[model samples]
Target: MAKIVKPLSDQQLLRYSRHIMLPNMDIDGQEKLWNSKVLIIGVGGLGCAVAQYLACSGIGKLTLVDDDKVDKTNLQRQVLHTENNVGLNKCDSAKQSLQQLNSEITIDTHTIRLTGEVLLQTIQEHDVVVDCSDNLTTRNELNLLCFKTKTPLVSGAAIRMEGQVATFTMDKDQPCYQCISSMFGEQELTCSESGILSPVVGVIGSLQATETIKLLVQIGEVLSSRLLMFDAVTMSFNEFKLNQNLTCSVCSK
Candidate 1:
């Protein structure tokens, strides 16, 4: 069943006036965003940036998932949390921030880690999923779930002045995360261990947000089938074509 979004009200028209003025994203695109639902998995640097942009953009329903609590260490890049929220759950803190950004939008918070049946149910509830998780395990799980459910996924990662963003729509001819993960073995390095530049995650997260909006509005060329890699040291971006592995387990059918 398709969601029937109400026409923008006078306040909404003024609120999104700049967006409506755009050639690509006029009233129709803004309405599409108003009716769209997005599930964001993670509340760290990437998640914070992604959530902030999407919230301000007027996404109809934004669900934030994270099991961690805010820490003093996160203040540097986790823009959604302040020193006052240092002890609160990341999802709760993020919800507060997002609500403050746009009171009209609905913000849902899940403070538990996603897995098994819960993960599947959550993914099915949203039109799109954004993977801002840190670990390979969570990323792999999200990839499989999105593929199985046929939900579009916008994935982003940042660490040590390097960042990458990709979109997977579960198209049989397109490459999924599992296909890309298979190329890079099991080694995983986290920001705490490697040390990350603050703005790197911001750049990647912003890109993820852009891709998400583009996907929802059906405007512009999406990042699907391409992996965008950013190097802060050189301030350059490289694009790589992703190939689907026909023999791989996930999305091979």
Candidate 2:
């Protein structure tokens, strides 16, 4: 006889009943979610949403990495934090919120800055890596690390009224984040200067969580070679095709 998969316990069934009811995310998908592990590189605006959704969605383990502390300004787009969390490390606040959101899943917090060697060590432990960082420098570093480790990376960014998301796989054909950055250059605005809408970040971050889940469950088509761009002001969505740059320092490796 084929191996029998255990059914979810009553409490777990109750907690994820809605997801269990969906054909796409039935018990099997939920089981896959429950067994998958994801590493989120930042606990800011995008990380806040990505972590919350992934934890609540039944991911088995999460490793959060961030070096910043909460401040009054982060309240605008960093919903996982609050006024009380000011001066506290973002990882601490995120852990508090995630534990409250779902105590069933385990969270591992890293309160240190991510650098070359450190980044590689962390990516090796998780099944997928989510880049919720805000700067191009750290973003490129993470892309290189993920590619070198042969890990799937779900990269998302939001600023002003626009946001973009893409999944980079280390299959040699997919356009990595470094490739995209080289083509577009780092001409985008930052929230510190240009500002961002809270909901815009929320929308993009939530999609990052969705993409992470899809990649973890091995369900649906992963956004491996396409960029999903959203413009909230016009409420328009566009997908631009992306190819692995032959000269890409990261992807070409």
Candidate 3:
């Protein structure tokens, strides 16, 4: 069943006036965003940035999943958490921040790590899924689930001074994360070990948020079938075409 979009109130029009004034995103596009639901995995650096922007932009519903707690180390890049939130569950802490940004939007928090059937069910409920998780395992799982369900996914990753963002719509000709990951073999680097630049995640995360909005509003060219890479050291942005793998273990079926 298709969800019916409610008429925007005067307050909503005023709140989103800037967006409504944009030629690409007028009232109709803003309404589409107001009726959309997005699930964000991992409330880390990338997740925090993505949630913050979406919340302010008025995404109807946001589900934040993360089992980890806020640590002192996260303060540098995870802007959604503060020193006072240290030791608190990341999801709860993020909820507090997002609510402060936009109390009108509904925010759901999940404190436990998502896996198995539970994860699949959660992904099935949302209009779009944003992958902010760090591990290849979790990324692969999300890609497979999103592919099976035909949900659009905005994926981002950052390590050291490099970052990348991609969108997977599970289109027949589009490649899933597994297809891209397979080309590079197994990933062994992590932000904790490699030390990511604070702004790198922000850059990639912001792009993921932009892609999610574009997908929901049905406007502009999304990152689908393409990968956008950023190098903070050299301050350069590059894009690469992503090809579907017919024998991809996750999306072939």
Candidate 4:
């Protein structure tokens, strides 16, 4: 007496054939990705790439959050929003674009600033929370909430010619994002202030997507307790270990 394993449909098998053929991915990994739900905050540049890749990869569901409307200036880096999508809410614009990419996946958009109980419940609902957010306040808030819900977090940020990505498994023994931000003294900066290269975000956001897929499929070594930095100026990458801050408020006693 053996358990039954439902096979992927012809359409799914065809759609995800590339993934199913991978040595590590195969059918089981593709199935796990199909069953995973990922929450992405900030449907801007990073969000655009993250959601697009996740959707096309066959993730079961994706929830996007963003209160801001698309501005003409966003076209430079936020590649998802076209001239026609200008003035549309980012979440709406992103959903429309992502829907065009993959119809099998469910895409939910929250066209409002995510905060309070709503934020808590949203994170709790998803398996992974991706922070493509620009501001430090939101990132810190997400880190704390993700910790509370014991959900894994994949965080990314791009400003000027530099970008960074990190992950927190929300394990009690692991170092959370606040552990690293506190080390930087929480300096707040936006793309408008510092300016970002058009492709720089794509590079980082693609990495974020890569990290998310690895998290979902439980493949390879995750970036937990580590930060990856990329400098477009030098065209090089660097990595650093993030240790829990002993005196810090979050992820520490």
Candidate 5:
């Protein structure tokens, strides 16, 4: 456990007074959040909500990576960017919004597309990684890198009024994203094809934020080896057990 060097300033304490009141999230947990770092890949619908929550929660540092620019179509679900930011790089827009939400957080924006090398380096820098990208290829790549670096990954996806969230790590000997991908098979639909409800992303993204906080504070059981499925229309959630694949090329190999 890390110790606080100095008492929080009155204003700082006042700002986080509510968080300080949580039983498990006392001054120490708040300090842990302030000292921890996280990286979010893809600033799309889910990423928008995840960034807003994490940034406002007083995370010390946040690295946002995205290659695309804000577009009119993105306004439907991507809440972080607005009409005025339509042409701006998504990462840049996210940085600006995150800074305004919590100036205390150090926000780093990368406008370039994420390759394996960049993803590996960014994961190494942060204590936790959140996958909000829409594609499976990126998610699989991220999972491999996370496993290789021993970093914990929070993965979330939302489509057509439903969503899912899971945490993957090699640390607990739990099934990784690679295992899930292999079990489910690679065929998946993008939000573009199936369409996603606005609040569906919000629900899953908030869960991602929750898991990220837990990982940062090293408290509570992460969703390792469990697939949490959410249904917005029915407002119900179900979790299925996940199994590690001994033959998984990315994790087992």
Candidate 6:
């Protein structure tokens, strides 16, 4: 966590001039993000948006985890992969594109499905973890590992015309993802199962990126302890406060 943050290069100043101009994100904040490492799980729609923006925003190192490959069907929503890279692994495809987006940053790819052994150490290595995976099991597992490590987690999901974004600070006083999942119960919504609009994931993913930047740079009000829901059909956005469950299996004990 005490990694040295070097001074911005002339090209960095030129590339991220807009971010450097912002109040809290001056050279110091930009340098912080430029030196930070972020672990992103999944390379689907939500992952595409989150990774792309963070790349463009100049997050120093982005480690992407996904066992899946690029599918022809994913072309509609997964913006990072190209038709030419259809048969390629998603993490490999994302690394290629994201590196092109920002040559100054480093992009790492892991082409394996995460397990308990891999997830725990990975969460401990990164400053923040973004849960963009599609399954309930993975989300639940990532939440628990993140809580154990006390690393911040930003989660997003989009199916059909609706999406939601939430952040877990991994603070004892704040709610863990398990608390929310307990209330809502598990109901996996895969794009293949129910279908999804192209831009719906974009909206949600961009918000996730926004929250991540705030967390990384230590600026702006983040979505911590709050849930943000979006309805593309009605174009309405709603916010809900989240409370810790004292009986939560992961966080309570």
Best by lDDT: 1
Candidate number that wins on lDDT, 5 or 6: 6
Cα lDDT tens digits, model 5, 1-253, are 6644444567877899899999888888888888888999999998999999999888888999899999888899899998899999999988888888998778998888787786788889889999999888888899989999999999999889999999986675578898877766567887778888888888899999999999888788889889999998899999999888888887776
Q: Model 3: how large is the Cα RMSD against the reference?
A: 1.0
Candidate 4 C-alpha lDDT tens digits along 1-253: 7633445688999999999999999999998888888999999889988888899999988999999999999999887899999999999998888888988888988988989898999998899999999888898999999989999999999989999999899887789988887756556777888888989899989999999999989999999989999999999999998888887688776
Residue pairs clashing, model 5: none
lDDT of 2 by residue, 141-163 (tens): 88888888999999999989999
Clashes of each: 0, 0, 0, 0, 0, 0
C-alpha displacement of 181 in model 5, angstroms?
0.7
**CA RMSD, predictions in order:** 0.9, 2.7, 1.0, 2.5, 2.1, 1.2
Best by TM-score: 1
Work out the TM-score per prediction. Answer: 0.98, 0.94, 0.97, 0.95, 0.94, 0.97
Q: Distance from true position, residue 97, model 1, in Å?
A: 1.2
Model 3 clash number: 0
Residue 82 local lDDT, model 6: 99
What's model 5's overall lDDT?
0.88
Backbone clashes in candidate 1 total 0
* lDDT of each residue in 144-205, candidate 6, tens digit only: 99988899999999999999999999986889899888876566668999999999999999
Q: What is the per-residue lDDT of model 1 for residues 1-253, given as tens digits with 9 covering 90 to 100?
A: 8767778888999999998999999999999999989999999999999999999998999999999999999999999999999999999999888888999999998999989899999999999999999998999999999999999999999999999999998876888999988878678898889999999999999999999999999999999989999999999999999889887788887
Poorest lDDT segment (10 consecutive residues) of candidate 4: 1-10
Can you give the lDDT of residue 123 in candidate 4? 91
The sequence of per-residue lDDT tens digits that candidate 3 reaches over residues 192-214 is 88898898889988999999999
Model 2 alpha-carbon drift over 4 Å, by segment: 1-8, 186-188
* lDDT at 167, model 1: 96
